[model samples]
Target chain A: MRSEIIITLVGMGIVTYLTRVLFIVGMKGDRLPPFVVRWLSYVPVAVLTAIICPMIAAPEKHLNLTYDNPYLVAGILTTIIAVATKNLVITVIGGMGVILLLKFLVG
Target chain B: MSGPTFDRRQIWKGFAESVPVMVSVFAFGLVYGVLAVQSGLTVLEAFLSCVIVLAGMSQFASLPLFAAGISPLTIIGTTFIINMRHLIMGASIAGKFTERGLFGKAAASYFLIDESFAMATAYAEKKKGGSVRDYMIGSGIAVFAAWNIGTILGALFGNFLGDPKEFGLDFAAAAAFIGLLVPQIRGKGDILVLLIAAALSVGAYLTFEGSWYILITGITASLAGALVTRDEK
Candidate 1:
């Protein structure tokens, strides 16, 4: 198990690094297609939403939209604060504060 | 003019910009470490994963599969898909590094995670004469150090630290990603794409295994963006 885990981690690291440097190495002097650049522009926002939303709506490996789910409540609150403040520090603090408060009260 | 060399100011700028999000990244890293240990990984294994793989989303995504005793090949494939965005990220930033030699580019690329890419790209577009390579390397190193240190603390003391989710630390990554996502919402098309991605991501999570939802949501949402923006173009 230990050796297998090591191999897996090393393999994953190499693959990740290779993918990161792929275009830098191969497309040294080439211009990316307009459509491809446009496509890439959307990747960050798309990937971020994909990663964040499910986390809020289904944190415990299942869809839990109920009020009891602190993550759901905090997530929604954080979204609102994020849009309002546009500050990462405040948003995290606000979200974590609310969830911690809820945890203490609920417990 | 001075010869080409790494700019200390650019590095400082990168380090300063990353400070805002580093806390959350650290917290996120802590969550991963705790979860990795809980999923049967030793402290060393979890720590190495943070330092080596260095891709937060893919690392988190792989944990469940590892716990399930899945084959390493399949797990790697899943991580590969989850991290495919880095390819696009690399492509987007490739133009800015044209002057960097192969060794410099390789070193700069080694640490290009999402937060660093965001900061580095913004700096590249706006800076007067600084090295984008140094800025990204700085940002990446800062995040890299924070993440690995957090992981070590989490792994070594995870048994003593209790459950991260209980204190809402587990949501740190989601919240951090949200902060990053909000500023990028530019138009009605972007909003629609976000909604579609969110819905699809949740659907994928509920229906599928591992982190395939990320890939599915990413592809479908990007396609939606392409279609919606087609009229604007």
Candidate 2:
């Protein structure tokens, strides 16, 4: 493995452990401010949308909004499945199936 | 003061309740492992990531950035933000551990994943006197074992599978993100945040040159959404 990769993994591990351990050990009885909790609740949806939007909209690092973009079509379908089913396993597996079928027919 | 005794019944109950969740976690881990190897991580690196990081979403989010050759610091920073929710989860679970000693609390904290936290919370609500800590540890161990095993097997399979794009695995990350995000959208505020983040992130990807878009959009959109919906309740 590359040295940089190792450093990144270890850094990630330390920060992750800190996030989990801090409140349990140091701030046993304290509660996070309600606003902070609310803000934090929004983090996952925002960050996840940020990540997913580009991958689907610009899979080639440039805009491609047509059916030729398998990621886009498959992503939309995946989102529907996810929202409707609310099951991770089904969404992922179903998404992959859509992509494969698209690639087979279009690509 | 002595720590609470390790209740085998509570542990067993926790482990049993986690079986359904374990299946999904294993599936997620399998995808992560495959994507990790496909994104240029060696098998050892992929396996180590599961063992060390243990946070599947952050680990999955890092793959594309890592594959793009983004700096280590940026990837690590992204990991921190992605896992920040754990702080809230830990705080909520801490109430159950007031009787636990420092060592016991610290040790139990290591096993605190999303599934374990939810399982412990539900167990506490359902049962009157059973040990939540023991339940958490049991569920944690079950999740940990499934995740690591799935990762190893998937990593090996990915190593042999050659190109991920052939199998349409390239879209797995986006698919996984959607699966994670959609379930969390409970109100108009969340939808607003999602739209804003999506627009800003795509714009940033086109305008900027690096992965800073994620961090910038995450912080800006969430804060804006929270403030805008502050009076909704």
Candidate 3:
């Protein structure tokens, strides 16, 4: 690898590792206030929602809420399947199947 | 403090639960590998990023910047910003590792990717007690293996694989996230948090240019949740 590539990768690695490790290392064995714990408890749901909504709403980088958008159609149906079954494997399989079917039909 | 006991059963459970998400991670890694090589990175560099950086999205984000001849510091800074969400994920799971010593916590931190974090969190929510630290490690290893293997294969033969989107591989991550998120919802409060986060996330995603929407929406919605819900004894 080139010197610049090496430096960039190493730098990126260091910072990324820091981000992953900082809080866990810093707060180990330390108790926090109850409200702080409560806030942290909500992090997973909030963060996952934040990540998922945009991707499904705009699979092509622009919002398309119509039925023509296979991602929207599949995302909604997959979510329903997820809620009804609560099985990750089935949800994923059903999701991929629905999207492929939608693409084949819509195309 | 005692080190975390590496429970084989919990680890196996973690690995098994992670299998569903691994499909998407592998797909993304393949896509990343192809893009990295296409962007002028050598196969070694692409593989090295997967092994060391281990953050797929930031790695993907950095490729364009690196190809554009941006300064190394700029690329690395953008990477830091893109991965800032890890801080919240780490803090959220930190409480679970209180019994573990620094060495255990430090070791576990390397495996704190988004998928593993979500899986471990969901697992913890479902099961009243177990070694989440060990579970996280197991799931992390499973994801790490899938990613690296996919990168190697993709870099080697990416041209023939075609677009991952054509097969709807891109939806795998969204589907996995949905599956994990749905089980965590119990009451009206959880539903409220989900709605607020989703609305703000979509709005901020449309409005903003970078990955800051995740951190912005995550913190704001979670804080709103904390304030609105009554404290249980």
Best by TM-score: 2
RMSD of each: 5.0, 2.3, 6.8
* TM-score per candidate, chains pooled: 0.71, 0.92, 0.60
**Best-to-worst ranking by TM-score:** 2, 1, 3
CAPRI classification of candidate 1: acceptable
Best by DockQ: 2
The candidates' DockQ values read 0.49, 0.74, 0.45
Write one digit per residue (lDDT tens) for candidate 3, span B179-233.
Answer: 7689878777678889999999999989987666776887789899989886542
Q: Candidate 2 on B189-224: residue-level lDDT in tens? A: 999999999999999988899999999888889899
Q: Assess chain B of each prediction and give its TM-score.
A: 0.72, 0.92, 0.68
- Comparing 2 with 3 on lDDT, the higher-scoring candidate is 2
lDDT of 2 at B226: 82
Clashes of each: 0, 0, 0
Over A1-107, each residue of candidate 1 has an lDDT whose tens digit, in order, gives 58999999988898888878888666765676666555656766777888788778887788898998877888888889999998765776687787888778888
| Greater-DockQ candidate between 1 and 2 | 2
Residue-level lDDT tens digits of model 1 in B1-233: 55446667877888888997788788777766766776678888998998889998778767766776877876776676657778777877887874657777887778789999998888888856677888898899889988898888777766665666765666655666677689889877678788888888898889987667777777778777876675343
Residue B225 local lDDT, model 2: 91
